[model samples]
Target: MSARSKKINNMAYGKLCLLLLILSGLSLTIHAKLSSNFYSSTCPNALTIVKQEIAKAIKIEARIGASLLRLHFHGCFVNGCDGSLLLDDTSTLLGEKTANANNNSVRGFEVVDNIKANLEKACPGVVSCADILAIAARDAVVYYGGPFWKVKLGRRDSLTANRSAANVFIPQPSFNLSNLTSSFATVCYKLYVVLGLCGHTVGFARCTSFRPHIYNDTNIDSAFAKSLQNTCPRSGNDNVLQPLDYQTRFRFDDKYYQNLLVKKGLLHSDQQLYNGNKADSLAKKYAMKQGDFFKDFAKSMIRMGNIKPLTGNNGQIRTNCRKPN
Candidate 1:
C-alpha cells in the first residue's frame, strides 16, 4: 500500500478506537474524572479496609460475595453508583431498597455499613459511600475468584433514592435477551449486558423470580425444571433460593454461559441468550473460553460502574451510608 493509504487507514483506526471507548463507557474524559488512586492521599487505607471487610464477609458466608456485588449493581443501575440504594426510607424519601426489582431480593447492606464504619474509624469522612460500593463490588468479585480491575473512585453519594427509577432500570429475571440489551443500551452496549449478567455466575436467585422459567418455560432442561419444581411450587415458597449457575453456584466462572448452551439456565432471560440468536455464538465462545469471559467481565464491570456518576462538587460524601449529611 502507498504511504498515503497507510496514513488514511491509521486515521480510520483511531476514529474506531475512540468510538469504542465512548460506547464502552471508558471515555478518556470519564477516566480523568474518576481515578483508581482518588483516595491515595486523603485516605490511603480506603481500599485495604474495604477489601478486608469484604473478605471477612465472604468467608463467613460465600453467598455474601454475590450479595455485595448485587447491591452495587442495583445501586449503580438506578442512580449511577451513587449509594442511593443504601439509603433507608426517610420521612420524605422512598429508597431504592423497596423498589420492585430490589425489594427483599438485593441483600448485603449490613456489609456496606460495616465497611463504612471501619473506614470512618481509619479516616473519618474521607471515603464516599458511592466509592465504597464500587470498591466493595470489585473485592466481592475477586473474593469469588472473578477477575479484578481497578475501581475508579471520587464518586459522591446521592441525597435521594428513586424507587421508580430502580424498578424501571434494573433488568429483571423475566426479561428476554432483547429486553436485557435494551435495558443496558442507554448506559452500555449489547456486550455489556451479556457480561454484566455474569453476576449470576456467583449468586442465587429467589424462586419467585425464576419460577415461571422452571414451571412453564420449555427452553429449560426437563431434569433441571423437575428438580426445582419440588422446592418452587406453582404457588407460595417465593423466597426459596436456587443457584443461578447450578454447576458452580458459589464459584465465579464461565459456567453461566455453559449452562445456557445446554438449556439449563435457571432464568428465562438467561436461556434467551442462546436460542439460535446473535448471542448464541457469543455464549458458546465464553463457555469454551473462561479466560476471555473473565477479561470481558472485568471490563464490563468497570464500564457499568461508570454510568452517570456524580463527581466533583455535584454530590456530597456521606458519613453514614444510609443517610446523607
Candidate 2:
C-alpha cells in the first residue's frame, strides 16, 4: 500500500485502540462498585461470621438453606439487591413482606436478623443488610452441597421498601413459559434465568401454590400428581407443602431438570422449562449433566447478585435488618 493509505490505516487502528481502552475503563469502574473483598478493611470477618450463623441454622433445619437463598432472590428482584424485602412495614414505609407474592410465602427473616445482630457486633455500621443477604445466599447454597462462588459485596440497604414493586417483579408459580422467560430476562438472559430456576432443586412449594398444577394440569405424571393431590387437597388446607423435586428435594442437584423431563415438576412455571419450548433443549442438557447445571447455576447466581446494587455512598447500613438506620 502507499504511504498515504498506510497512514490512514494507522489512524483508524489508533482510534479503535482508544475506543477499546475507554470501554475497558468503564467496565472496571462498574465492577469496582462491588468487590469480593469489599469488607476487607471495614469488616474482615463478615463472611466468616455470616457462614457460621448459616451453618447453625442449616443444621437445625436443612430447608432453611433454600429459604435464605429465596430471600436473596426476593430482595434482588425488586428495586435491585437493596434489602428492601427485609424491611418491616412502618408507619411511613410499606415493606415487601406483605406483597402478594411474598406474604405468607417468603421465610427466614429471623435468620437474617440473627446474622445482622452478629455483624453489627463485629463491624457496627460497616456491613449492610444487602451485603449480608448476598453473602448468606452463597453460604446457604454451599451449606446445602451446592457449588460455591465468591459473593461480590458492598451493597447498601434501601431506606424504603416498595411492596408494589415486589408484587410486580417477583415471578408467580402460575406464570406460563413466556411470562417466566420474560420475568427472568429482565435481570439477565434466558439461559441464566433457567440456571437460576435450578435453585428449585433444593426447595418445596406450598399446596396453595402447586394445587392447580397437581390437580388440574394435564402434563404432570398421573401417579406423581395423585401423590401431591393427597398432600394438597382440593378445597382447603392450602398451607400443606410438597417438594418441588420430590426425587431429591433436600439436595442441590440436577434432578430438578430430570423431574421436568417426566412432567414431575411441581410448579407450572417449572414444567414450562421443558414444555417443548426455547428452554426445553437447555433443560434437557442440564438434566443430563449435573456438573454443567451446578457450574451454570453458580455463575447465573453471581450475575443475579450483581443486579442494580446500591453501592458507594448510596443507601445505608441498617443496624436492624428489618428497619433502616
Q: Model 1, 153-222: lDDT tens per residue?
A: 8898889988999888887889875566556555543534444566789889899989999988889889
TM-score leader: 1
What's model 1's lDDT at 208? Answer: 91
Q: Considering only N, C-alpha and C atoms within 3 Å, which residue pairs clash in candidate 1?
A: none
TM-score of each: 0.90, 0.89
